[model samples]
Target: MSTAMSAAWPYPLLADMVLAVHFGVVLFVIGGLVLVFVGNRLATWPWVNALWFRMAHLVAIGVVAAQSWLGMVCPLTTLEAWLREQAGEASHDQSFVAYWLQRLMFFTAPEWVFAVAYTAFGLLVVLAWWRYPPRVARSRG
Candidate 1:
């Protein structure tokens, strides 16, 4: 194919990759808590109680909640939109994958609904932190 077509081809693929990453992050923030609680209960997956893991999980959800409350768009969403536009596609209405994922994660409700939902989820993450307190590594003499 022409150079122009070759150059343009990667944009849609890159956009899809970004969408996949965004989906993974959403899953981590939501599912991480389940792993933490259940793993702790089962006494399996000890790494779930690691301080760093717990803190990172908390921070991820906290950012989402804060962005919603501040009426700000997520950076990942912005990047995906820009990439889709570069690929000559509408940000949210283009590919089947994008359309379905957007429908699953996004809604046309008022801003406060998102803010409240995110805030509630964030609170749950915080509670998980307390419920399964992270373990501190001891120094060996």
Candidate 2:
């Protein structure tokens, strides 16, 4: 791939629409946690892999958060926008992060809201990490 293409590569897109669906999943998992905290029965289903799923969700969110803070564009975001363009849909040309994330994710949080939310989300991931730590031992075996 050329530099332009490489800059927007979709390791994330190819890896689970990682730019989009993962965001959706993270939101869902977090929302589910809130429900569980509120004593929702759905949060207590026997077949639900809540702990493992939330751990994965939180980790993915952490990676995305780190990338944003470091000023690195997400490959998945690039690829998805490219795919949308190919499909004749609109894409963000250029703008502040606040504008696009708000439009794409339907989030209207203020700048401080985003900062606080990210910090809280990061804390959640840390807590989950303490509880789970990713099960690498089992996976390697």
Winner by TM-score: 1
- Each model's TM-score? 0.88, 0.47
lDDT (Cα, 0-100) at 141 in candidate 2: 50
Q: Could you give candidate 1's per-residue lDDT for residues 1-141 as a string of tens digits?
A: 887767678888888888888998999998998999899999978889988889899899989999998889999889988887787776654678877877777779899998998899888888887888898766699
Q: What tens-digit string does per-residue lDDT give for candidate 2 at 6-88? A: 75454323433434464665566567445433433454543233556555667666776776566665665666656545434
Local distance difference test scores for all models: 0.85, 0.53
Model 1: which ten-residue window has the lowest total lDDT? Answer: 86-95
Any idea what lDDT model 1 has?
Answer: 0.85
